[model samples]
Target: MFLKRIVLSLFCFHVVLGKTPEIREDVRKFPDGFLFGVASASYQVEGAWDEDGKSESIWDHDTHKIPSPIDDMSTGDIADDSYHLYKRDVEMVREMGVDFYRISLSWTRIMPTSFPDKINQAGVDYYNNLINELLKHNIKPMITLFHWDMPQKLQEMGGWTNPNIVDWYGDYVRTAYELFGDRVKYWITINEPTQICLYGYGLNLLAPRLNIPGVADYLCSKNLLLAHARAYHIYDEEFRASQGGNISITLSAQWYEPESELYATASREYLQFDSGVYAHPIFSKEGDWPSIVKEKVARKSAEQGFARSRLPDFTPEEIEYVRGTSDFFGLNHYSSYFVNMDEDTINSYAVPSRADDIGVNVFKLNEWVLSEFSSTDYVPWGFYKLLNYFREEYDNPPIFITENGFGTYYTGLDDDERVTYYRGYIGAVLDAIDDGTNIIGYTAWCLMDNFEWTKGYTVRYGIYHVDFESPNRTRTPRKSAFVYKEIVRTRSLDIGFEPDTSVMTIDEGH
Candidate 1:
């Protein structure tokens, strides 16, 4: 035991001194029964925005009405034409040799009226065909019910901020379960509620740019959580026994590292605000908002002259309904931030803003390596810490890394940086597994390049490159795709493995 402690101390010292840890071949091997898959969202990939009785989503409305809302002045009106090319997408998924494919169902596409009053048969046919194609190739399907593409009709009706959205969303989710739950074993109720509530509602950075900060964003959080719980309960009570499927919500969980030990509490508070707001109600033993979040937001609201806290409170019944709603923890992680406690940070943010309410400043370290085309920095240690944090804080719930990938500019077929990013982050996963994290599966962020929300096509997170300018929107596998394929095929991470990028083809029996 003394010798083991000495070796562990040396390993920690090397890690702190920026020395690379020795990679053992055994460390690279994934546990048997661990799953690998790739992911894509509806608005990001599917075109045919207005075709086949499909109504407009908030993304369609925002991109059409707001000038230069996207970085490339581009709209997802015809992203990748996946509506027409889903078979090719299934082919790509097969080529990657994954266990499943994660895709989202567009709310407006299935229910053009944004309600169960009418179901669009044509939209149902589209997904039916995709799911059938995937199953034909022996690939399981994991479907996300919502991925930040609320129907324009719903937005006009106050969207997620209105308490009535719970029933509306419950009706939509019930219709979806009745339609596709039989084929889909994994169902994600909503993807990245933090991104939906904070970016879209608070910062005006995403669709339906409400920009009401601490007010509208908080309302969206409560209503969205209730809606998610509604969907989970509807499935649990109505569909689970018949379908034998699992349902959960996805949260964007970037690590919040403190700049110094002094600001550790600040960093924890930031994470509580960022992810805990959405995750706590579902995963926490208490089944309510984090105590720190409630206290801080309420105290700030009082000082801001508000009669009540900006953060909404959950009723006792609502709390009970939300607790244990998720079958698994769906996480989408990318990068990390160093947070510091600074009183002056409040002045930089808009008054009563989420940032000001949290009362911390976050920034990336200059020494960290950034992705080629985006602000994401390489910090696999953060990923390792985050998984362990989830295990410790949330009672080690089964975790599926529903989205993890690096974005880059169109740098042709050789994407070495992305390859490195995957290797490092996935290595972190293996480390977490060794330390007893109940991680079940891993998923790449996307299958191919498509419309990347505000970034548009400027940032590509796909293993396969899509030529957005081409009439066919042709997709060609990048070097990272081959590397990822090898990892999937072998169920091990070969840090020194190099693929022959001359030609890409599906492996035998894939």
Candidate 2:
């Protein structure tokens, strides 16, 4: 009888295992016109924080003034030193064989005074060199106007929460359009509003740390949406006709699933708070806050004795203005979480945080091997599910995966785990396209390791690992870099194909 029971258990295990999807190379190749690229932000990669007439950004101020927030207490003051090494950086991109490169403009560098009255020639010359280098190599340039590095001068008056930033950001976008729009065809207006609002203002995890939770984050959200719409309109009306470019605001979303069938509503609530609140405003058929977000936040605020909802309202005109502003659904997805409705979860403090507002306890899967900065479980299916959700809810808008990659603290040359992660994620993207999602492009999170904000230099997310301790911040191509290069070159994934070791080289600024 015991033997029979063991046999039954083995049968069930085999059945369950067989049902799980595996990352195999047998799938159809990615569709034609699917772009492959790599992404990096200005403050994260570009050093020279105070060089060539560059003013201090919020990141510069935060890392210098309050280094405690960063894990290693390191600043981007000399990060990668891309300011001086941009030619080498572009050479690395050219070697990778990517179709394009996504980079952000440093707001403070362009307009040190945070006004258009004085345009810095040095900053203009620097971008021109970088853009020209990419163009010379046949690599298209996709520029992001802002990536959480606001000029400190602007933040002093009040950053995104001030409402006046809509115009301030508009002026900045117009300046960028005027300067580089002819050379750059793809424009990402802003990168991850949720991170800027919730993490920076509400949680105080990033630059210009406000930590105001319920009030500041919501205010920032409203203003950010307005600012994005204003920029999109500026480009569409003024620049698009001449330059023929596309504009979008990237939103970083983590796929959320219910901890169990019982917590389905909790998962949905978590999703609404994380990405829906931001996406619904610009992407939904009817612009404005997601109904669930409005209702839940209002209920929570009422419970906390607030006279009105913590989330600021959008006027009818404002909603219409913001609606359909995005040309493509620019997404920056990293990982996934399992959420459960739990009241006893810690709220950081007694005050209502974004997590507290949602009242959901989020957890990583126990099966996922936790690295210094990654989840080894690497659920690519979550990405597939996310794309399907967008298709069903947001009317199948054109999507560009603006940023996606794995990170680790280890600087090992053989990053087999990263290769596997990319294989699975990119495969899932292909699956989504076959399943009718309008995904246009995919850009790996970073071209090389640089300053990782609050985590400082602890976490590395680049295919080409940067030796931060080196005088030149040497670039070493890991095995994943070779794998990525092959994938980009072939325009197809072949799991059995081994990368050529010859492609892995140590860049000593040669």
Best by TM-score: 1
CA-RMSD of model 2: 7.0
Number of residue pairs clashing in candidate 1, backbone atoms closer than 3 angstroms, sequence gap of 3 or more or interchain: 0
Q: Could you say which candidate leads in lDDT?
A: 1
lDDT of 1 by residue, 341-397 (tens): 666765789978889888889988766765445445788888888887788678899
TM-score of 2: 0.93
Worst ten-residue run, lDDT, model 1?
Answer: 12-21
Error of 2 at 252 (Å): 0.3
Q: What is the C-alpha RMSD of each candidate to the true structure, in Å?
A: 4.6, 7.0
Clashes of each: 0, 0
